[model samples]
Target: MKRALITGVTGQDGSYLAEHLLRCGYEVWGLLRGQPSPHRSRISRIADDLKFVEGDLLDQSSLVAAVDRAQPDEVYNLAAISYVPMSWQQADLTGEVTGLGVLRMLEAIRMVSGIGRSGTTSMAGQIRFYQASSSEMFGKVREVPQNEDTALHPRSPYGVAKTYGHFITRNYRESFGLFAVSGILFNHESPRRGREFVTRKISRAAARISKGLQSELRLGNLDAVRDWGFAGDYVKAMHLMLQQGNPGDYVVGTGRTHSVRDAVRIAFETVGLDWSRHVVCDSRLVRPAEVDLLCADPKRARAQLGWEPTVDFDELVRMMVEADLERAEREQRDVARAPTEPEGDW
Candidate 1:
């Protein structure tokens, strides 16, 4: 079986990609910095199936060791300081992990693949690399429905870091002739999405309010637009990138834009609630630098990779809301079953 090592395997995209690789008969190994906890519910279902390699993006030696241990035919660098607001607070950390870390991974791959001083490979050109580039790179877009050729004008520290990563990936591909590709992915979400993300937060709040568990949902930038797709569908495109005869950057997205208000409205409507009743606009939550709009032009991905998104916007929202609703119901049931403290215990 082919061996694949995926960084950030516990994340939504990584979890879906792991499942995809497993089904394709690949021996999947995950690079993790710490002990695997059940709390990583995204990958909990397949945790036992994954081999773990201890490593950190911030540590080049650890990454080299991980590459040596896994001996993967392909390496997916998905681990990064992904959150935008957090990137602002920890700019230096994001720079180390999200930006410079790509260089370390490329170097590790070079050493492992036996690429010589001339930067040419001999082991049948093995050890392909896929860097998870983000649509956030198109912060202040120069054109509508951004393609691979659009100029990057990143606004946030996270986007700037990703832009660096993207350039380096392309640089290595050109200079070293490494089989490296970067997928400029748009905003993709799923039920496994962390609650810190706006989509998940909205879905969770909608589910909670439907069951009378939450009073209100505070949000910022309801007018901000994003091109969203299903995480599962996007992972297929990642896999397809490696299967190609040549390496090139591709934009992966739904080719449509939807506002945060649209997501919140659809989420609430799914659960038979009016969003205006519960949503509170909090200016404090707004980003210091916001990308007003981001939509993708995935013509290349479609024409070249033979890939297309299977889930639509309404369906995606419905799926997230339903999953959150199920979780809330389970939590409510657990609370009901727990033994109560004595009335005078306090």
Candidate 2:
């Protein structure tokens, strides 16, 4: 059976990708940074099927050890300081984990694959690599519906780091003949999304507000537009990229744009609530350098990998809202079952 190692295996995309790989009959192993949490409930479902290794992106030796232990034929580098706003506050940390981390992974692959030897006969040449590049790399887009050919003008440190990772993946493919490819993914969300992310925050708020547990939802730049797709659908494209005979970058998205306001409206509407009444625009939530719009031209991914988004914009919003609502209901039930303190009992 083919073996695959995934960094950031606890994340939303990582969980879905792990499940996908397992279903396809691959022996999947994941790199965990620390002790596992219940929050990784998505991957925890398939815990029996997954092999875990403790590692960190900041430590190159740990990554090399992970690559050695997993002995994977494919490595998916998804671990990074992914939060955009967090990147602003922790620019140096972002540069270390997101930017320098790619180089470390590539080096780890090289070490494990036995680089410096020539020809396809080498094991390193045989192992494939996939880097998760974000469409945020196209921040301050020169044009609408960015394709692979678009010049990267990243606005935030996070985007800048992803851009660096993208180029390095390409460099490894060209210079070392490693089967390394970068998937320039647009905004993709799912129920498993972290509450810190805007999409999930909105969905969670909508669910809670509908249940009368929340009074308001605060956000920034309601006009900032992004091309969103389903996380489940996008992970397929990542797998497809590695299956290809050639190693090349591809942009993946639904080729459509929607604003934060649009997302809020749909999310609230899904729960039968009016977003305008409950939503507030907080300037404090705005970014230092915002990426106003990011729409994708996913023709290359479609034509090359035979991949297209299965979930549309409306469907994605509804799915998140529904999932959050169910979660809220479960939590509420748990709270009701808990025994309360006997009226001021010492």
Candidate 3:
């Protein structure tokens, strides 16, 4: 079995990608910073099959050891400090993790060529690299339906860091003749989305409120738009990129956009509630630098990978809300015997 390594196994996309690669008959290994959380629910169906190894993106020594130990045929660099507003508070750390982290991984790969590291098993030419670039890189939206060729004007520190990761992937491919590809994925969500994000926060809170478990849901910038797609479908595009005869960057997303208000409406609509009554827009919740619009031009992915978003916006929202409701209802029903824990902290 070809070994596949993912850097962010705990994340939504990484979890889905692990499942996809495992189903494709690859032995999956994950690079994790620490041990698994006992309270956290895993989205990856093949969690038992995935081998997790401790590694840190900021540490070159750890990455080198991880690469050597995993000896992966393909490496997916999906780990990043991705939340935009949080990036403002942790700007420098975001740069270190999201931008320079890619550099550190690439350096580890290059060093495996027997250039710098002693007694390192070399497979630099054989390992394929996949970088999880984002549509956030096109922050402020110079042009609608942002494509691979679109000029980037990133508005947030998160976006700026992703842009660096994107170009660095290109640098590795061109300079080292390695099989490296960048997927400029737009906003893709699923049930596993971190509640810190607006969509999941909306759906989870709305579900709780419908169950009489919460008071109200707060949000900001309901007018900001995003081209959201299914995380499952986008993860397929990442795998497709590795299967291609030649490596190239591809834009992976649904070719449409929806306002944040639209998401709130759909999410609450799923719970059979009027969102206008419960959604309190707090001015403080707004990002200091907002990415006003994002729409994806996914023609290249369609043509190259024969890919299109399988789930539309309405269905996507429904799936998320339904999952939230299931989770909340189960929690309430089991409360008599179940051990109580604090709310999900990050």
CA lDDT of every candidate: 0.93, 0.91, 0.88
Candidate 1 per-residue lDDT over residues 227-246, each given as its tens digit: 99999999999999999998
TM-score (all chains, Cα) for each model: 0.97, 0.96, 0.92
Candidate 2 on 239-317: residue-level lDDT in tens?
9998987789999999999999999999999999889999999999999888998999999999989998899999999
Off by over 4 Å in 3: 35-40, 43-45, 113-125, 334-346
Candidate of highest lDDT? 1
Ten residues in sequence with the least summed lDDT for candidate 2: 116-125
Q: Which candidate has the highest TM-score of all? A: 1
RMSD of candidates 1 onward, in order: 1.5, 1.8, 5.1
User: In candidate 1, how many Å is residue 309 off?
Assistant: 0.2
Error of 2 at 245 (Å): 1.0
Model 3 earns a TM-score of: 0.92
Q: Candidate 3's error at 230, in angstroms?
A: 0.7
Worst 10 residues of 1 by lDDT: 116-125
| Worst lDDT 10-window in candidate 3 | 115-124
Where model 1 places Cα greater than 4 Å from the true spot, the runs are 36-39, 121-123
Model 2 alpha-carbon miss at residue 186, Å? 0.3
* TM-score attained by model 2: 0.96
